[model samples]
Target: MESFNAGDVAEKIMAAIQKEYKELKTLNVMVLGKTGVGKSTLINNMFSEKLADTGIGKPVTDKIRKIEKPDFPLAIYDTPGLELGGQNVVNALLADVTEEIKKGISSGDIGKMIHCIWYCISTPSHRFEQTEVDFLKAFLNQTSLINVPVIVVLTQSYSKADARSLTAEIEKENLPIVKVVPVLAEDYEIDEEYVAKAFGLDTLSEIINNVIPEAVKKTFIAVQCANLEIKKRRAQAIVATAAITAAATGAIPIPFSDAALLVPEQITMIGSITAVFGIRLEKGTIYAILSATIGTAGTTILGRTVVSNLLKLIPVAGSVAGGIISGATAAALTAALGEAYITILARVVKGEMNVKDISTAKGKKEIARIFKDLLKIKRDNNGTAIESEIETSADNTNSFEIND
Candidate 1:
């Protein structure tokens, strides 16, 4: 933990408590924009699952998507597409937000918290339709969901220049701009740095440091501490298993001929399967598809050899000898490997490691202290930002009504 500057037990407690209080409650982040602006795709990517459908066609996310994250639960309401005609479109969009907000109220704690809103738009064209502009104006003017941060995610950005120009233009809209996160989904520029920036680290950190009630924070920290203890216990189990095997083998010397041959193949197969646990392909396919298959294969064979020799104490070669060697080795190693893999996979799936979870008690406290200092960075040239800007003019025309 120190190598990564993550602190000890105290730090984990501090960070965990802060994060829990600030983020534990259910949050609804509405993805609002014109039809076909990639809102569903954004949520799908955020969740790392096909929770919502996405394509070039017209908006398919007519309903809302409720997703649960590690820290909090949320419902991402994808509003209906606005009509090409003016007032009718405004009414429809307004109605949708209002209904969702009410629904949130009905849902109790999760419903009441609309922590953030993201308005997605496509880039380069930088054109706004009447429907789009009207919707933005109506949303700003009519909604009571104030103070909630609004981010403009520009989808489909190609060049750096596009991002730069768009960021500047968007700031001029008089909206309470939080950030402009750029996405080049087609180009694979989707990184945690940008998304975290969009989510307002300063605010989030503040919540970690100060906003959450102290009692709640303590409970959350306790849960994380419990989980960490479980990991430590599993590791101890593995060590004990290995030590017992070694002691048994030292008492007797059995021929390694049959055991040696079978052990490597078994280890190799297990290692290969474990290595490709999340992959979509079959077990055989992983071996054939991955270039590192040979390395994985070798690791398995070596691992088994080490275990077999260490298990030699039983008298005379028999099925029991093989069973003890195989069972103990596989059980110990498999449990260790499975736990480790799940921890890594969870982070990969969630888009970032829990820095707060991994932080030292002191460092986490410092991070909590500096929560207010964290800032969201904006990218200039995304598609979502362009649509937001284009819609600004119409919003301006109805300024008195929307901004009121």
Candidate 2:
């Protein structure tokens, strides 16, 4: 018997399981934290709903309550906030979500996986108790929930710069920092940019209006648009060349700094190239290779171009010879690739042939025929060779041949 590695076999098993259970869609999230830290507030902000009670002075939530929404259905189980020296909050949360899943299996509403774990913490600086630290310690030890994506919602705080330091400390200690959000429930004029960033949305307004009423939603959306637009426009002005080079190369060392500054300019240059040649390549697909090559060559070429040009102006080599072109060609290539990428993207957005032909009748029939043909793949009489041997014995030689 042949042996297979656990990982390879497990991957095949998982693929089979996924195909078998494809109907399961909604992602259930379990929110756990100390009371009064704003788990309810976070959910309300997420769904644009006032369903979860806010301004609760104390830990009013006692049981695991489910918070559901329209566009995104969240079986948000809000467990009782962790106490200073009482029952462990992590245990309570895990138990609750596990029970919910069990009940769901019977009730036919079980979600496939736990999508998010929003661990609401007010501010680690203010509440760095031994209990919290121990809880965190145990939290990381539990590998059972490793598959679930967790985000530490640092609520009731301000300034991303400050958040960065806090996040760095946690990361240094090896804590999973999916996202850090500083939210103020009282101001309720929530910064949608942070929300959009945390949730991976193109625009913040898309999420805001759905939560607030028509009149208030309109006002909030307008203000958010203005604020975000101003930030975007200002970003569009300065081109951080070194940062762009780093981004292109994939040696992005900065943590808190934005990748946007570097990416867009490179993207624009690549887009230009794509447009000219009518050929497209994803910046992401070729970013590292191009960035590495272009950064080195471009740097050299640019240096020589300056030297050559300067030498030409001099009486000795005036117009006879010029400095080596450090960046001209590499820069041009980057620009061309960027342009081509953009043109391709635009065509993609306009609905070109971007979809896989898996649903076509001919394709389906071909797949079915292939599967039917697989039945022909049989072991030889010796059974030593695993080959596509469609046998046609004398008794049943009606007319059968192997089809490719």
Q: What are the lDDT figures for the candidates, one per model?
A: 0.38, 0.38
lDDT of 2 by residue, 31-57 (tens): 777777766766565442343653222
Q: Model 1: how far is 23 from its true place, Å?
A: 12
Q: Lowest-lDDT window of 10 residues in candidate 1?
A: 375-384
What lDDT tens digits, residue by residue, belong to model 1 across residues 1-404?
A: 11111122223323333443444343355677656766665666453234455322233235344444443333455654534456765665567666665554566554355555666766664654445555665575544354445666776555456656776666556655556666654433347554312322222223322322333332222222112322233333433343344333332222332332223332332332222222122333223211111112212322333334322211121133533433333332322222333333234334444433323343223222221111011111110111121111212222110000
TM-score of 1: 0.40
- What is the alpha-carbon lDDT of model 1 when measured against the actual structure? 0.38
Instruction: Evaluate residue 101 in candidate 1 and report its C-alpha lDDT on the 0 to 100 scale.
Output: 59
Number of the top-ranking candidate, with TM-score as the measure: 1
| lDDT score of residue 154 within candidate 1 | 71
Query: Candidate 2 — worst ten consecutive residues by lDDT sum?
Result: 293-302
